[model samples]
Target chain A: MKSLFFPVLLAALLAGCSGTPSKVASIEDRSVTATETKFVADKPLVETMGKPPDATSTSSSLPLPAAGRSGVAVETRGLVAPSTDVMGLAEAKAAEAAAKAADTGATAKSGGVQDAAILPYSGGMNQADMKDPASLLSKRRVQFDYDSAAIRDEFHAMLEAHAKYMKTNSSARAILQGNTDERGSREYNLALGQRRAESVFKALNLLGVPEGQMEAVSMGEEKPLSEGHDEAAWQQNRRTEILYQGE
Target chain B: MTIEIVGGATNRIPIAILPFLVAPELASGTSDPALVVAGDLGRSGYFKLLDTSTVSGLPADPESLPLAPWKALGADAVVVGQIKPQGSERVEVRFWLFDPVRQTRLSALSYTTTRAGLRGVAHRISDAVHQALLGEPGAYGGRIAYIVKHHGHYELQVADADSQNAVTVTSSPEPLISPAWSPDGRRLAYVSFEDKKPVVYVQNLADGYRRAVAKFRGSNSAPAWSPDGRRLAVALSKDETSQIYSLDLLTGDATRLTQGGALDTEPEFSPDGLWLYFTSDRGGSPQIYRESLSTGKVNRVTFEGNYNVSPALSPDGRTLAFIHRRDSQFHVAVMDLNNHQLQVLTDSTQDESPSFAGNGRVLLYATMVQGRGVLATVSIDGKIRQRLSQGGDLREPAWGR
Candidate 1:
C-alpha cells in the first residue's frame, strides 16, 4: 500500500478529473493504458519536419501506433484526460510564443543553447547546413506552440537551414500537409490545418525555395497517430506531415 | 458612396432604384440582372421592389443611350454605370445612383475586382441602395449552419448561403451528429455515441463543457428546447416505437406529449408557445404537423414535398421552411402557413436542416460539395445566394434561438 500510494495519487493528479496537485499526480502515474482515452489525430510532430500537417485523422483515435513502431512515447502529462466524452484541442500558441521569448532572454542572460534547452533528451539540428532533411524535420516539431499552426521562433533557424537545402535540391518536390486535433468543427479545423501547412510553406518560400517546388493542403481531423482515448494519444495526433516525394 | 434620402413619414415620398449598369467586362460572369439585383435586396428584407418592365426608365450612358420616353415612367430615380476591362481576370466598374424626383445623382462609385468577384460587387451596390432607401444594413454577407452525414457520422457546419464553408463540427468513428443550438447563442445540443449508445448532450460554446441531458435506458434523442428555456422535449424509443416526451429540467418530471407507433420527432414551439410543430410519418409520407398546446389538436401543414425531414418556422410567424426533394436532390423550401404555398429557396442540391436566422429573413441548410458536407444559406425570397468555405463533412447546423 505504501509503495503504490504515491503512484496512485500522481495518476489522479495528471488526469485531474479532480483539480488538485496530488490528484493530477495520481493520474500521471496510473496504468499507462486505462487512463481516459483521448482520440489521437493522424499527423504528429515528427511528420511536420518534412511536410505540411494534416489534421483530419488525429482526432479519430487516441494514441494510435505510428508506422513501423517508432519509439515515440506520446506525453499526455497535463493536457487531457480519458473519462470526458467530448474533446477539444490546445490553444497553445501563446505559451509557445512565451517559451521562445524566454529562450531568447535566457540566451542573453545565461549564454548558449545548453542553458536554453528545456527538453533534456532533445536538442534540435540548429547548426545543420541547408538541404539536410534529417535535421530539418527534427526542428519543426519540438519547438512549436499548442494549437498554433505557425512554425516557432526556435524553428525559424532550423527552417532557414531546411529551406536553403530545398532551394539547392531542385529535384525535391514537397507536399506540405497541415493538420489539427479534434477540438474544433471540421471546416474550421481544415482551414486551421491549411494555415499550419501554409505557415510551413511560407518558411520554405522565405528560404528562396520557389513556390512551384512546394504545395500545401489541409486534412482536418481525418486520421490518427495513436489509438487511445486519453491525452497521451491526442498529443501524438496534433501534427503536420511533410510528404517527401523524393527524386 | 453614401446617399441620404430623408423625408417625413406621413407624405411617404416615392423612390425608385435606377438599374445599375456594369461595364461589359464586369458583366461577363453574371447570369441574370435579377441575380445581382435581388441578391442584395432580398437578403436585407427591406425592399419594396417595383415592376418597371413596362417603364422606359434608363440611366445616363458612359456609352450610347437612346433618349426620349424617360418622363412617362414613374421612376423617381436612375443610375448609370461605366466599365473598363483591367485584364483577362480583372475588371474596373463604375456606377452612379440618381434620384429622378430630385433630378440629382444620389451616388457615384467606382471599384475594381477580379472577374470572379463581380457577384460581390453587385451585392455592394445592393448594400448602397439599402443604406440609401431604408437606412438599414444588407444581408449579402452573413452565412448559415447546417448538417450532413457521411459513413453514418453526422456533422454540423457553418457556411455561406451558396453552400460554401463546408466545415465539420464533430466527426466520430462512432457518429457525433444532430446539432441544435441553445436560444442564447452560447451553447449547442447534439447527439453523440461516445457511450456506444445514442444520447444527447448540451455543450457550452465558451468552454466546451459537455454533459449528457437525455440518457434514458433504451434510446433518448431528438431534443428540442422551449423558447422560454425551461422544458426539453425529446423523442425516446421504447418497446419498438418512438414517442415524444418533455422533460422539466427543474423537476426531473417527464411528460409524454406524443404517443403511438409513428415517429414523432423534431418538435419546435411557435414564438407564442401556444403551438408545437413537428415532423411525423403518421400521415404516411413525412410532413410538418402542428399540435395546439391549448387544444392538443394536430393538423398536417405540407402536402407537396414527398420527403421533408427538418422544418424551421420563419421568424415572422408566417412561413414554415423545410427540405423538399425534387429530381433526386433535396432543396430548402418555404411554405406560406396560411395559403399552403411552397416556394423553394435553394435549388439543384441536397439541402437539409433548415434554420431561420435571427431576423427570419433567410434560411440555413446543409448540402454536399464534391461528396463533402457543407452549410449553406438562402434568402426566403429565393433571390440572394452566397457560398462559404470547405472543410470536411458537416451535418445538422441549428442556429441559436
Candidate 2:
C-alpha cells in the first residue's frame, strides 16, 4: 500500500508539474489553431467571448480539472511549436496556478503570484491573450461592404478589446492595412482602401488608443484575398487587417 | 504582344507597301523596314494596306519604278524602300512614296542609323508618310509605360507605341501602379508599396535612380506631374481622409490644394497648368472636378453620370477622358471640355486608366477581357480601336513622346 500511494502521489505531482508547460504551449499554439478553427468550429467560442473579458467574467476564474490539465498536453502535439515552447509552457503553468488560486477565492494571493510570474515574462500574458482563442485580438480582420468604409456593428466589441490593450500597453504599435475589391480605378480604389483603414484608425483613437501607435495605409485592389470576379469574392477582398509589431 | 484592330474609319486611305531590297551582307543584320511601316499604317485605322507580294521585282528607285501597274492594281499611293550597309556598324535606308493615281512622285527620304535603330528609323518614315498624306503628326514615334503583373510579381515596363520591344524598368514582389510620365519624358512618377505602404516615387528612366518623393505619415499615392515637372499633385491621408496635396520636389514641402471632408484623389494637371482636375465625392457621388490654381474656384466636370473618375486631359486640353459606370459596367468615356458633350468610347465592361497619346488623337487605356487585363487604344472620334495583350496582365498605360 505504501509503494502504490507513493507512485500515485508522484504521478499526481508529475501531472501537475507537466500540466503548466502544456497550457503555456497550448496558448502559444492558439494563434494557428484559433485561425484554422475560426472558420468552422469556433463560432460558439466567439459568441461566448463576444464581449471583452472583464474582471467579473467567470471564464477567467474557471479552474481546470486534473483530466483537463493533462488533455492540454495531448493538444500541443499537433500544433506548430513556437520558438519559446519551453518558456511558454512554464508561463502557462503559472497562469494555471493563478487560475486555481482564483477559483479557491484567494484573490489577493492569486493577484500577487500572477503579477510575480508575469513580470519575468515581460508582457507574455498580454501576448498570450492576444493569441488566445477566446480573446478578441484573435479576430484581426474587419470586413466592409461594397464601396463603404463604415465599420460593422459586430466588430465594435473586438475593436474595443484591441483599443483597451493598446491603451494599457503604450509600447504596442499596430499597422492597419486596408484593401479593396478589384473594381473601379486602381487609384480610386487605393483612396477607398485608405478610407477603410482610416475608419478603423479613427475608431481606435476614439476608444483611447493613441494616434502615434497606429498607422493607416492602403493596399488598393492589388492584393485580393479571393481571386474570383464575382460579388462573393469581392466581399472578402474589401477589409482591413490589424497587425501588431513583433508578433 | 498581340494586336487586334476593331472597327475602321469610313474612308480609309489605300496604300501599298512594297518589300524593301536588302544588300547581301546587310540582309542578315536588318529588320524589314517595309514591314514595320506597313504595320504602323495598317493599325492606324486611317490607311488600308494593298497587297504587293504578287509584284514582279523590287524597284531600285523612283526613276526605275513603274506606277502604271500599281495604278492598275487600284493603289492610290505606293511606298518602295531599300536597305544597304553604310559603315561597319551603321546602315542606310532609303524610301520613296509615289502617287499611283496622280502618276507622280509624292516624297522621298533617306535615313542613316545603327542596325538596332532600324525600327525607330522605320517608325520615323511612317510618321513622314502619315504627315505628308494627312497633314498631322503621327503617334508612332512615341513610347508608352505600363504595369505588368506576372506570377504574383509586378513589373513596370516601357515599350514602343506598338507594344513591341518591351523593356522591364522595374520589378518587385510588392505592387507598383499609377505610372505618370513627366513632361520631358525622361522620368516617371509612380506609386510603390514596397515599404508595406503606398508611397509615391519618382524614377529617372535613363539611370534607374529613384527616390520616395511623397513618404508622408499616411498613404501617399496618385502622383500627377505638373506641367513644368517641378512638382507633383498627390493624395494623402495624413491630415484627413484622402485629400489632394501639391508636393514640391525640390523642397519636399506639401501644400494642401484641396480641403473639406470628402475623399479626393486621382489628380491631373491640365496642359497649360491652369487647372487641376481630380476625382472627388464631395458632391454625394464620385465625379470629375477641376480646381483653378490661380483662384480656388471649383467646378464639377461630369454631370450626366454619378460615377465618373480617373480624369485624363488631352494634350490640347479640349477633351477630358474618364471612366464612367453605367448599369454596373465601367467604360471609357470622353467629354468635350468646351461643349460638354459626352461619348462612351469602349464596349468593355471594366475599363480604367485612360491616357491620351502624344498626338491627342488616340486614348490608351486598360480593360479586362475574359478576366485578364489588357491594354487598349481608341481614337478620339471613337471610330478606331486596338487591343494589345501579352503573357502577363497589363494596366496603367501612360503614353509619352
Candidate 3:
C-alpha cells in the first residue's frame, strides 16, 4: 500500500506545483489538474488513485432529504467500485506537508492540508468537480444499445452523482446532447437520438433535477464518435453526453 | 463530376447531334450546345448518340443539311442547331429535330437569352427534344439540392440536373443535411447543426435570406413543405420524443400532428394536401405511416421489413419511395399506393434519402460507393441507373422544378 501511495502523493505535489489550487484549498482542482496532465504525460502518476469511495456512502449516511436519495447513493457506490478505484491515502501526514510546500511556492494558496483531509466526507461539488477524474460528475457519457433509449445499469452511479451535484448547485444548467450510429435514415436517427437524450433528461428529473435546469437535444448520426462502419464503432457512437453550462 | 450508366433500355433511339455553328464573337463565352444536349440525352438512357466525327461541315441550318447521309449512318433522328449573336450581350439559339427515315422535321424552336444563360438554353433544348420524341416532359431543366462534405466542412449546394453550374447555398463547419425544396422551387428547408443541435432553417434561393423556422427547445428537424407552400411539416421534440408538427410560415404557429410515446419523424405531405406521411416506430419497429390532415386518423403504409423510413412521395401521389433495410444492408424501395406492391429499386448496400425527380420517372438517392458517398439515379421501373460522383462526399439529394 505504501508503494502505491507514493506516486499519488508525488502526483498531487507535482499537480500543486503546476499552479493548480492546493488540494487543501480544493480537492476538486487538484484531482482535475492531475488527470488533465495524466492524459498528456505522466501516465503513472495517478494510475492507482481511484475515485473517493466513501463520498457516496457519507452522503447517503447524512440526514435524508428525499426518499430516493439513499437508495440511489448505495447503488452508485456498487457500480462505481469495480471500474474505478478510490484514491487511498496511506501516508496522509507526509503527503499533506509536501502538497502545502508545493502549493505555497506555486501560487497564493489558502485552506491548508487540513481541508483536504476532510473533503472525502463532505460530498460537495463546485465547478471544478466537473473536470475531476475522481468525481462521478466527470463521467459524462451514457451509452445505449442499438435502437434503445433505456439507460443501462452501469451508468446509474454516474447519473446519481450528477443528480446530486445538480440538486446541490441550484444555478447550474445542463444540456444533454444525444448521438447515434450511421445505420438508418438520417431523420429517423435524429428522432432516435432525441429519444435517448429525453430518456436521460427524464432520469435526471426523476432524481430531482428541475426541468428548467436541463435541455435535451439530438445530434443524430451526423456527429459520430467513430467513423468506421462497423458494430464496434456503432457502440461508441450511440451515447448521450452531459454538458454543463458556463464550463 | 463523372456519370456512369449502368443499365439501359434495349430499344434506345439512335440519334445524332451535329456540332452547332457558333458565331465567332459568342464562341469564346459559351460552350458547345450540341455537346451539352448529347450529354443530357445519352446519360438519360433513352437515346443512343450516334457518332458525328466523320461529318464534313457544320450545318448553317437544318434546311441546308442532307438527311441521306445521316440515314445511311443508321441514325433514326438527327438534331442540328446554330448559335448567332442577337445583340451585344445576347445570343439566339435555334435547334431543329428531324426524322431521317421519314425525311420530315419533327420540331423547331428558338430562344434568345443573355450569353451567361447559354447553359440553361442548352438544357431547355434537351427538354424540347425529349418532349418531341418521348411525349413526356424531361427533367433535365430542373435543379438538384444536396449536401457536400469536403475539407472538413459541409456545404449545401444547388446545381443543374446534369450537376453543372453549382452554387453553394450554405457552408458551415458543422453538418447540414436533409435539404427539401419548396413546391415553387423558390426556397429550401434543411437541418443545420451550427448551434450544437439540430434546427430546421428555410432559406430563399434567390436572395439567400434564411430564417430558423423550427428553433424549438429540443431537436427540430425533418422539414417537409406542403404542396400549397403555406406551411412546413417538421418533426420536433420540444414536448415529447420527436412528434410531427405543422409550422405555419406566416404566423409561426406549430400544431402537433402526431401523438404517442413512440418516435415519429420524416414528415412528408401528399400532393393533394389530404394526408401527411411520416416514419413512426409505434408498431415496435420503424415503418411509414400517414395521418389525415382533416380527420387526424393514422394508418400504417409499409408492413414489409422491420425498418422502412424517409418516405418521399411522388408528384402524382401514386408512389412512395423510402429506405428499406434487408439483412442489415439498406436499399432504396418504391411502393405503389394503389396496389401496395413494393419493388426494391437499388442493389447498393448503403442506399438512403430517395427523392423523385420532377417528372416522377426517376428517383435520385445517395449511396456508399467504396466508403464514399455519391448520388445515383434509377428509373421508376428499376431499369436504367446512373451514378453521379464528384470530388467530395455528396448526399441528401432533392430534385426541384
Candidate 4:
C-alpha cells in the first residue's frame, strides 16, 4: 500500500498539472493497433484544439518505417494537443516510438516514399491560382439539375479529384457555396442549396476526407451567375462553387 | 419605372376628388391631400377617378357646392375636404363624401393629425369613401414589409399601402429574406444571414429592438407568424434535414410538427389557425401541404402542378396563393379553396414570393423585370396588374394589418 501511494500521488499530480495528460502518455506506451481505439476515444480532445498543423514537419524528421507507424501517432498528438508541455512531451515520445518501430518493423522499408506522396502540393498554388484556368483545381464547380442535388456522372471525375486532394492534404479547407435557380420560395431554395452542398460533402467524406475541412453554405438564388430567365440560364445558376480558404 | 394604373377599368365606379382647401393659418406646406386620395383610389382598381382639374368652381363645403357639375363630369361620388389649423403643429381635416346621383351627402369624417400625417389622414378618408360605396374592406392605411437587395446590402423596408413613406427597418451586409409581418403590424419576423448561417429574428417596428428567435445548429430560417402572434412556424435543419417546427414565442420552446427525411419548409398559418401550410418534397417533388393542428393529419394542398411552393392564404381563408410551375415557367397562381379552381395570376417566368393584402382582393409578389427583382400586384380576379420598380431589386414582400 505504501509503494502504491507514491506512484498514485505522482499520477494525480501529473493529471492535475495538465488536463488529460495520462490519456496521451498511455498511447505512447501501447502498440499501434492497440492505441487506435484509444486514439478514437481521444479524437474529441484533438478536434477541440482546432485544425492541426500540416504533417510536413513530422514526416521530414522521422525515417520511412517509423514515420509510417508514427504518422498515425503524430496525427493523434500534434493535431490533438497544442503547445502545452504535455503535448510537446507526447509528440516527442510518439516520434521516438515511431523511430524504434521503423527500425524493427518490416513494413518500414517503403515508408519514406509513402510519406513524400502524402505531402500537399506546395508549389505556387494559392487562392488566386485556384481560379486560373490552367490549374486542375479550376474545375471546382458541380452543377445540378432543377430542384435536384445529385451529382451527374460527368462531374464524378472532378469531384473525385477534389476528394482525393482534400484527403491527402488535411490542413487545407474549402467552402462549398450551393445555389439554386429563381423558381421556388427563397426559404425552400436555401434548403435545396444546403442539400446540394451536403451531397458534395458526403461524397468527400465517402472518399475518407474529414468533414472539418469542408463547410457547406447555401447562397440560394440570391447570387445568380446567369441573369437570364430561360432554361439555359437556369441550368448555369443551379450550381455549387468550391472556394478554398483565402481564395 | 413605377407603374401607375387608375380608373381605366370598364366596370370601375367613377369618383371625383376635389382639391382640399387649406385654411390660411396651416396652408404653408404644399400638401395635396386630394391628390393622395385620388392615387389611393386609383390603385385599388375599383374606382374610375374623374379628372379634377377640368372642373371649375369647386367648393370645399359640401352644403354650398352644387352636384350638377360633378354629375356632368360623370362622377358617381365626389369627395371634398377642408384642412383647418388644430394647434401650432396639428391640423384638422373634415371631409364629406357626396353622392352625385342622389345629390346627398353619403358620409363625413373629421380627422385631427400632425402635418406629417396628412397622407395618413387622406388614406383614411379614402378608405371611408371606398367602404361607403364598394361595401368592401379597404387597404389604404395598411403597411407592407419587403426586403430590397441594393449595392450589395440587404435592407428590410416597411412602406405604406400606396408605396409611400418607405422606412428602412434594418440593413445588413448579408442577405435578409422572408419578411413576415405580425398580425398587429407592430413586429416583423425575418431570416438574416448575418452570422453566415440562416437565423430567424423578430424585430419590434416601434423601437427596432430585435432578438434572435431561432439559432439552432445547421439553419433556422423561414419564420411565419401564427394568427395569434404568440407562436412562429419556422424551418430548421438542426435534425440533419430541413423540417417544419413551431416555436412558442412566450415559452421559447420549439415543437416539431412534421417528421420525414425529405425537406419541409415555407410554413404559413390558416386564417382560423386550424391548419399549418408548408412546402415539402415528401411526395418526391416540392408541393404545398397542410397539417391539421388538432388531428395531426397531413393533406397535400396542390395537386395540379408538379411543383408548387410558398403557400400564402388569403385574408378570408378562401384562396391559397403560391408559386406554381407550368411548362418550366414559374408564375404566381391562386386556388380557390371552396371550388378548387386554380387560376394563374402572373405572366412572368420567374415570379416568386406571393403575399396577400389585408383585404383578400389583391396580392403582392416578386418578379423579374429586365433582370432585376421588382414588386408587382394583381387583383385576385387575374386582372388589374401593376409593377413597382423604383427600388432596386426588391423581393419578399409581406402585406399586413
DockQ by candidate, in order: 0.01, 0.09, 0.09, 0.05
Off by more than 4 A, model 4 = A1-140, A153-175, A209-215, A228-232, A242-247, B6-8, B53-55, B58-60
In model 2 chain B, the worst 10-residue window by lDDT is B84-93
Q: In terms of TM-score, which candidate is strongest?
A: 3
- What tens-digit string does per-residue lDDT give for candidate 1 at B1-401? 01111111232323344455555534533433335555445333344444545566354563233223233454544434554454333444566565655555566565555433444455556656655665644445433444434444344433233332222223233445556666655456666544433466665433234567776643456667777767777765432234677778667677888766665677777877788887776876667788887888888888885666566786667888877777756788889888988988776475667788665776666666665555555667776544433334555666543
lDDT of 2 by residue, B151-179 (tens): 67677777778877665555565788999
Per-model TM values vs. the true structure: 0.44, 0.79, 0.80, 0.75
Worst 10 residues of 1 chain B by lDDT: B1-10
User: Chain B TM-score of model 2, please?
Assistant: 0.96
Report the lDDT tens digits of candidate 3 across residue range B1-401: 67899999889999999988887655543578899899999999999999998767665555578898889999989999877764343456777888989999888776655544567778888988898889988878888889888756677777778887555556565789999999988788999886667888887664444678888898999999999999999999988989999999999999999999889999999999999999999999999999999999999999998999999999999999999999998999999999999999899999989999888989999999999999999999999999998877889999997
Show the lowest summed lDDT stretch of 10 residues, model 2 chain A: A110-119
**Residues A124-201, candidate 2, lDDT per residue (tens digit)?**
334878788898989899999987999999999999999999988998888898999998999889889999999999
Task: Tell me the spans in candidate 1 whose CA falls farther than 4 Å from its real position.
Answer: A1-247, B1-173
Residue B102, candidate 3: C-alpha displacement in angstroms: 0.4
What is the fnat of candidate 3?
A: 0.23
Per-residue lDDT for B298 in model 3?
97
Worst 10 residues of 1 chain A by lDDT: A106-115
